[model samples]
Target: MPKMGFKKLFFFKPSPPPLSVSNNTFSDSLMEENIETARSVITECESQSPPLFTNTRQQAKQYLHAVITLQSTMQYLVERDSSSQKLVKAQFLMQIAMKRLQTEFYRILAENRDCLDPESVSGISSTDHQSSVSDYDDDFPEDDFQFAGDSFSTVAMADLKAIAECMVSAGYSKECVKIYILTRKSIVDEALYHLGVERFSFSQLQKMEWEVLETKIKYWLNAVRVATGTLFPGERALCDFIFGSPEKKIAESCFAEICREGAMSLFGFPENVAKCKKTSEKMFRTLDLYEAISDNWQHIESIFSFESTTSIRSQAVASQVRLGEAVRTMLMDFESAIQKESSKIPVPGGGIHPLTRYVMNYIAFLADYSNALADIVADWPKNPLPESYFQSPDRDGNNRSPEVVERFAWLILVLLCKLDAKAELYKDVALSYLFLANNMQYVVVKVRNSNLGFLLGDDWLTKHEAKVKEYVSKYERFGWSKVLALLPENPPAEMAMEQAKAIFQSFNAAVEETCRAQSSWVVSDPKLRDEIKVWIASKLVQRYWEYYEKYRGGLESVIRFSPDKLGNYLYEIVLFRAEESGSVSSHSASPPHRFKRS
Candidate 1:
């Protein structure tokens, strides 16, 4: 994949810095008190006959609840004083509490295995229980917590200080790993609830207090460097807790920070680049998995549309179709805007600008892609058809209806004629029209079996021919020498141009005679008439500068010919003449004034 362009890449916005923590002895005392309370609870749980309570179920629930409450309180302290020594102390104490709870729960279950019946067991098996306990113990190795000295009084003060210092330094990572490990265990236990003691540690971690643990983990991972000096084994698991679990917002913040800070450089310590290679691979793998599952357009739409589950294949196809349609709509708007501008005159020249022509060609290409995608999406099997009996159509059977293709062809030709007559940007505009004609031919061929073919084959072709002849006749009678000269040559331009102008004049006379003879014709929809007027005015204004620039020669002549004329002659003629009453008396005469040409 190509790297994203710098212009398109969004920059990371930094968050406000965390509040300062006062390093007072009072703060330390408070932290010590919280740790002591937590320790007392853990010790009490450890000393119970079955380690916590008489009944395994009751003891499991009580111990689980106590761990949750203590964890919550510890989290509160951490958030309240994130950088304080007390907060560090509370984090370690929380880990000890979590460890004791897990140990007692495991010990009780193991001792009471005989009491456990198959009926009481849910998804839990002996293997699962052992795995959960083992993973938990791995996070907090026994040697890390054990006191080896025979007499506490005889222990050297220096040794005690060294141990405390190590604990403080290791506190954040240890607590994070334990939380990650125990959280996984709790999920298994919950899934195996009927087995006996369903741990609530997982449920407890879902609380807002979990953010404190996550923040500490993020800070530590971004600060420390071990021998290999990379994020530890459980780092991704903790990330999963933040992102994959229900606390999505927290995870988003964490992951966004990782991405922003350049996770590889966050720790800023001398370590092998290869140290983070595995962790980076794992992180990217997880991200890829998430994107695969979450970014499907069909899945996203289903969330809103109340649809039945679609097969993965169909979902993938629908996602592509949705994207194609979005691109088509955007391209269409761009084309329409350009077309509106191209209608305007170029400066000093009596035609459209060359840049406008370039834009139109690009827009035409976009339109072609849009139409192609639409056809592809339309023919994709919405309702499955058996393949064994299918046969591809031959040229005769595949040929589009002549009328439909002819109509589109004529429309393209008419647009070309108008563009060639009026636009200075002739080359690309001409090429674009040719491309449009070719694609329309393809569309006709593709949709031959559909109603679009019938329209192109008969109705469109007849209407197009009639409209062209009518416009030609009107142009001739109006003494538009340029229009007559510019008539297409392949079909005998001169003869057709003459007959067209006569027919146009006759049609205008007949329509006026009929309308004046009937009052009802004059009373037709006022709102519609107003809307038409507004639409014409908007188109004119949008193309005013372009048209004036392109057709400056002809426009200046018209302006000079009728100096007092309120609207440009071409504008009035194009917009109003076709719809005007035929009676010469009813027609508003052009201003008689004439001015010298510039």
Candidate 2:
């Protein structure tokens, strides 16, 4: 047992050397009641050479309570003391007693923090313990709460933070704040290092760094919440601490670094299209992370004022801008990568290269931006899409002629043109029309299926539809004109059997040439294909029927023109167009025995 010598020290009061009548007041003695018991404890320490050893932890805690109460008593006395010398002595003694009991109280807590029945060791009532310790011993207690090497340091910190809570209850707000700052810094640094933010270098990225970064960011933000709430204990104060000057600066700096990394990851995507495809995928993963930030953005704004000095807008608003930049960067990279790929295969090719389909599809998936596209598409009208919407040369207000309502739509129009031009490059003109049809049809279908269609209005779809029809008409003119030319003019009713056979063979040859040439062509729009099919079937079926009826029997059985095959040939001819033969459903099964001379 150590000697607690201060007991006697207070009793052996020095002779009153100083007298100041001007400052002496009745209140001084009144305060003595609050501090007298604490002063009397020193008298016991003086009579004993050393304090008796406590038999159990409970006794030690009683001694700790005596010491702690003595500190508060001394502080109360010091504030009332009129003499400067008395004040200094009182303050010094209070510090010593506080330091000693703090060590003692905490040591007991550390030794018995586990197992059971902690109050018995501390001698603190359950109510006192709740106010002193339980505040920080929250559910799902953090394991790595403090120093990793110390087995019980985490619990010790919890206990310490709980003690801080007691101080807060005692109205030591500044002291509580200091504790909060220290705890917050420690937790954040530990989280950042554990999640690898310490080595978060952007230019030289390691795989999965973003994942680690995101995890750490969540931990850090939550730590800030818990920390600020503990220290300030109100809605407004949390906002000021989280989004205010120094702390907000720290969060923004971290976010800025993250954005730098994200930009490097997305904007500086590899030149190769395959790599870009993977990059596009990786870029979208950031979307979720960004969405989390966006959610925070919304969450914080609602809780925090925007116009107030402490508002998040003053600092964290950059998060919104950074999110926008990431989105724009991704969109720009997508277009550039596809355009770069387009350069690989020159425009004006007859058939779209498979890579072209792949690149086009990449944009198709990005159609999640469909609403944005709708906004852009709405700007351009169905009639005369202007080359540019220029502002008033004549000083008119907002006078952009044919004002480009939607820039994104304009971008899509460019892509459409690029697709058209690429299809044009195909030497097989028929195949080129098919490529255009497929690309155009895919876009129209996607827009209609998504909300983008409404914003674009019906005109956009109608115009593109007309464009598709024009392309189909061009295809028919290019691919089937020769076959159409073989529509037999009204056969001379008296024509010789040999002449009729020769004309039928010519007609059969023309039909065979057309079918063989276009057997594999594809038109993706079912309606567009049906239109072309009807056109070809009308030109061939009715004319061939007339010609067959006019001449089938005129070709005598002796000529062996194989009258048995005419119906079958006619059926096959009308049911054509390689994509689908069944749209031409009206072909008669049998040729009429129209051998009577018409």
In terms of lDDT, the best-performing candidate is 2
* Deviation (Å) of 456 in candidate 2: 2.6
Model 1: per-residue Cα lDDT over 1-598, one tens digit each: 0123211221122332333354556755555555566557656765655444332234434444445445555666767756655555555555555444334333333343333221122222112211111122212233432222222211111121222222223333333223323333333333233222212232342342433433433332223222012122122222332233223333333323322222222221112111222221122121222222224333233321212212323433443344334433443344344346333432221112233233323323222222233343343322221222112222355344333233233333334444544433424332233222222332333334344434334444344334434432332233222232232223232344445444334433443332232212111123323443354334333333332333334234232222212133323333322222222222222321121211
lDDT of 2 by residue, 104-187 (tens): 333433353341111112221112212232222234234434222243433443444343333433333343343234333333
Global local distance difference test of model 1: 0.32
In the predicted model 2, the residue pairs found to clash are: 7-42, 7-43, 348-424, 348-425, 348-426, 349-425, 349-426, 350-425, 350-426, 376-406
Cα lDDT listed for each candidate: 0.32, 0.43
Clashes of 2: 10
Candidate 2 Cα outliers beyond 4 Å, as residue runs:
1-32, 38-93, 100-178, 188-199, 206-292, 301-316, 319-359, 370-405, 488-494, 524-539, 554-598
TM-score of each: 0.21, 0.56
